[model samples]
Target: MADHRRPPPDILVIGAGLAGIACALDLSRAGLSVELLESSDGVGGRMRTDRKDGFLLDRGFQVFNTAYPQVKRRVSLRDLCLRPFTPGLLARTSTRLVRIADPIRRPGDAASLMPGRVLSARDLAALAALTTRDVLLPASILKRLPDRSTAAALTRAGISLSAAEELLRPFLSGVFLEDELETSARFFHMVWRSMARGNLCLPAAGIGAVPEQLAAGLPDGTLRLEAPVVTVTDSGVLLQDGSERPASTIVVATDGPTAACLLPGLTVPDGRTVTTYYHAADTSPLAEPTLVVDSSRAVLNTCVLTEVAPSYAPPGTALVSTSVLNDDRPGGEAVVRRRLAELYGTDTSAWTLIGAYIVEDALPAMVPPWPVSRTTRFAPDRYVCGDHRATGSVQGALASGTRAAREVLADLARQ
Candidate 1:
């Protein structure tokens, strides 16, 4: 099956995740021959979805934020049939469920946000100032702000310790996949701005549809699946199947660890772990598509998936997804079910477990002074791109990929 007469592609992108697909798409659009190789059976390295027993389960509890700049540029939101979650989250405190909603967005929830109910006067003032500044100002201004641990930033802004523990910590632990708010303050502000500006939604099909859409833009025969690259040869790469493909340039667009393996001396940050549990019930527990976090800290976050998008489950069935920062705990399923019962205020004993996904490297640790973007040029001919090289997010991945393509194009032009 060798086409010896035909020349090798100008560029070989080793990975078909969003970053690789984006790189290949940009390169090909510029009229270069590019091939994308995926180690797995399909694209969407981490964003993959599985259909089990007629239920659409995402690899993890994933939500697409329409506010991400890269998402808007790269995806057609209309085609995904997006369904939005409520603008705010519910915190299951000791006494009752406290609903913290955006007054401007959800005017009806204005009653829930009245002073002394959810957030104290001081906490409300501090958060309002933070949200208003982050939303109105440009990213450049926010990024230039002094960097510190997110916890420090919140405290410095006058958010009360009680509010941090009750509302912010529980909600953000799910977002950052870290219980401690040690992530960069800059990244936190940016994320906060995006949340305030955009709709947090899920696609009718699944989060995997986002990547599937990007891969569809590639030219025919541009992608090869299950073609794992064992090592980077001098002239190209050696595939796991014992094949050598030569190329003028190679971009390692895999995850942090894989990129480090392919391109030695590359810096790979520490990663966070997360586990998501999917449960199927005969009836819906929560009628609204809202995220619920526990002040008890038993579960990071949980939501009724079918409430957001009916297509996630078969007719008349409800799908609930819950995520914890770590893998299976000692108590396991029984513990999670009990926690869910408390959070949703409904008996979860009858709910059947669909699947549990433990993602070891859910997101790269974004410590203080982390670069928003980094150069992808690893060597003269070798390059790398992923969320690891930028902020750990969908926007970061896509942005890094496009940046790599630009760098490759410039390098090739000079040759």
Candidate 2:
């Protein structure tokens, strides 16, 4: 019998975001030598945290849908803290504001929600179809589905044209972050499955703490910050400070466009921006911590924050997150604050403006022709990973990292 102990690796992981961290941690656990290099001064790329004048702010306001696997495995519910969304909702329809309390754990919640006052019988039927028949339809070839994406399916199902534009399209765009025609048909099905499980959640402390905690768990010196990687050679990466580091395997886990620049033949299919206006003084502008969405509004689609997470703000202060959709961000911080005042009313004076986190290229293409598919999967030794690599969320980044780590583990197993 052979004494089979696997050989160690000079493993290199590029970018220190969640994906890179995940890969490094897993690889280290497997007894492989792992090094995670980050371009920024610290870890957590898009999910970076900003602390100034007493506020913990994430570079972008991200809401993790319940679909993530890390929620069960990696993300320690004890470390940072978390708050799940309520089953019911509060939606700002054109004519009325509907408050569906207990949306997550309730029945007939949608039926009981208000705002549908403006909806016609056709609109109601279409809304039901979008959630039930269209988005949730099985993507399997064995399961027959309507011809179009949820938006198109609604149209095919005799949903009135006005309803699609005024209601469904706006609501869907906020979630998909793209126009109805551009979104992939399959993505909605995934969302439906997650929604059936639960709504969403926010870190009880701050978004930055989640990524920071993961980094803390890794062996010391595994993660290196401010290591600007100019270009990733087949063997390893060339640093900006005029040093080259080599390893048996490398993972490009930087931002999408940034990754494209680092690796040849990587193109960003489509991009989107997420703009947030932070008011440090506004603690309780809205009566509840529900996600405020106005289907009739175009630019400023949705708003949510750490209202439920009491520790996120000062004793009576609040941090409000407002998102404007576009390939190009409209204006700077001033524009966002103006919109906040317009939507939430003067009562917003309770909170002061602490920071403005504008993620120019927020979400990568989770739809298709899937963006991840086009990236030439740099074979056996070299690799790429990020939110852009998998499903485009914190979980995607983690899963992609775990995937790359497993790849290295397999090679070790063989060695």
Q: Pick by lDDT: which candidate is best? A: 1
RMSD in angstroms, candidate 1? 1.4
Q: What is the lDDT of residue 363 in candidate 2?
A: 77
lDDT of 2 at 43: 78
The deviation in Å at residue 334 for candidate 1 is 1.6
Q: Which pairs clash in model 1?
A: none
lDDT tens readout by residue for model 2, 173-198 = 66766665455545554555556555
**Candidate 1 structure quality by residue, lDDT tens digits, 143-230:** 7898999999999999999899889988988888898899999889999999999999999999999999999999998998999999
Lowest lDDT block of 10, candidate 1: 1-10
